[model samples]
Target: MTASKDGSSRNTLQSELAPRDMTVTEEDVEPELSEFTTPVSPLPATERQESICAWIWDGCSMLEQQLKKKAIKTRFAEVLESEDAVLAAVTLPKFKLRWLRTQDRKDKAKASLLAECRKLVLDQDQQAGTSTSTPTCHQSRDSAIEDEFFSFEDEDDTSSTAESEVTDYFKSGAQEIDSLNGFALIKKISLRYNAATPSSAPVERLFSLGKLVITPKRNRLSDQKFEKLLVLRYNHWFNS
Candidate 1:
């Protein structure tokens, strides 16, 4: 009876010490797996869209700054505002009629324009002279000649004829005026001032050609040779 009681007590102790049946089910494991695998919520949809748009706008602004650096300089507009520009404009037949009308009324602008033309003519004669000795005499004579030549008579018939001439000059396809004939000095001045390019595209194109020619393999080329290569590259289309 004593052994039987002792065995029963030992079995009871073992049962208490042993772990309980703890088989995991899908329901128990799912929440744990989801906790690790699920992604954190991102910014709200509208906020995310706004951030993308802001990024694109910043990129565009950067690109615009880069392009502005390549734009042509606009200093030519300042040159067009000078007294010499008036003389240059007058060489065009379209402007000649307005100039004549201004001269007849003795407008200050016309006076300033005529003075500039006279100055340019005198300067040309002085440059052409073999000797610069006694510049005062030559200057006085030239001034008198210019004054008489440039003087306009306020005749209705003269005005009518000038208006007709201007109309006819444009009707003839506005061909290039003869540089050696009427208003040669003024024409030369016009060409000099108006020959500036409106944009730097041609210069930038040349730079691109230079880049293509001066690659790493040809980096040792001399300056003269590089220039020649650029010229050839630019004119390759002409050959084609």
Candidate 2:
């Protein structure tokens, strides 16, 4: 009994007298993540939203084509299946029209030509406005009269080109919003993840760093400790 007691005391003494550990740095002991963030933009809310919508258009177009290595096409409305996408697609075109009117063209002959075209359009619009006095019920009939008047005016000017372009654009836009006759099936085809700025690149990079940092030499870490370190590193990124 005394021998067992002495052996237990010696073991306790040896454990207590073991070499003291060197100080560990928070950085050396725990994983660290670099700072990354979204920058603040100075644009107005409407302008910002318009910019975002345009980017979405560019993204969706590329997603269906460049990323897939196929000749796929998709309408803005059907691609996202979200209310915001629909609103952005519709409102963005209207905003573009208003925004275009504010451009400052600085060519003499071109400016004069544009001025003449604008006058013709205004005059055509005025004639339609005056003819609307025929009758409220005959408004439908008056539209045919106005169309003829506008057609006559078109032959005398290059406004025909502008007007045709506008009509064609509107027609195409109408078709885009048509699912049955216009936009067809939008497949969620696989994108080239390795070839583009995927949404998960940032997360994947951090995970790769995690793999590198959690080495065999540091494999003694408990799961709870490792998780705490990850959370700390994540928070540290934003905090710093």
Candidate 3:
């Protein structure tokens, strides 16, 4: 009877230590792990929209800063403010018509444009040793007035022309400006200021072409030959 009791006790102990028929699913484990895991609450809709807008504004501001630096380096502001540039714009038929229509004081507008042109021509002549000195602004203004008097006389003779004919004359005048012989000094100054590129993209492209041509294998290429190769490669599309 004592031996039977010992076996029964062993069986009871084994039953207590045995693994149960149990399974742990993800759903069952998630709740327990969730207590230690911090919940990531999404931002409110309004806050998310504001954040997106701020990010966009920052990007735009960065671009604007970059463009401003480029403009300063290229003297874009100076060119825009230049009196010679104003004359150049006025010489163009489109801008000339716009100025005529916009300015209430027609004589003043014409005199100002003419004065700028006269000054530019005098400056150029002085640089070329053809003139002893540049005229003062007052002198330029006086000369412009005299020229405008003669120009007005000529205009008065053609005042009887139809409005359509006047428009046609202005349109045809564009060709004269394009020829660059009508206002050579003014055109030269205009071209000088306007020729500056806002970006160095073309120069960068040339450098990239040089890199492709002057590889490790062709490192011993002569400078002139490398330059020629770069040019030819860059202008290859022109041939097509």
lDDT of 3 by residue, 76-109 (tens): 7676556656556655545654554435544444
Candidate that would win on lDDT: 3
Tens digit per residue, CA lDDT, model 2, 115-160: 4335556576679878884546645877878887878655555465
Residue 43's lDDT within candidate 1 is: 69
- Model 1 residue runs over 4 Å out of place are 1-85, 97-109, 128-176, 197-202, 205-240
lDDT of each: 0.62, 0.51, 0.64
* Worst ten in a row by lDDT for model 1: 154-163
Span of ten consecutive residues with least summed lDDT in model 3 = 157-166
Per-residue lDDT tens digits for candidate 1, residues 23-94, read 999999999998789575666877999999999999999999877744532545454446556555655545
- Extract clashing residue pairs from model 2: none
Q: Which stretches in model 2 have alpha-carbon errors above 4 Å?
A: 1-197, 211-217
User: How close is every model to the real structure, measured as TM-score?
Assistant: 0.28, 0.19, 0.28
User: Which residue pairs clash within candidate 1?
Assistant: none
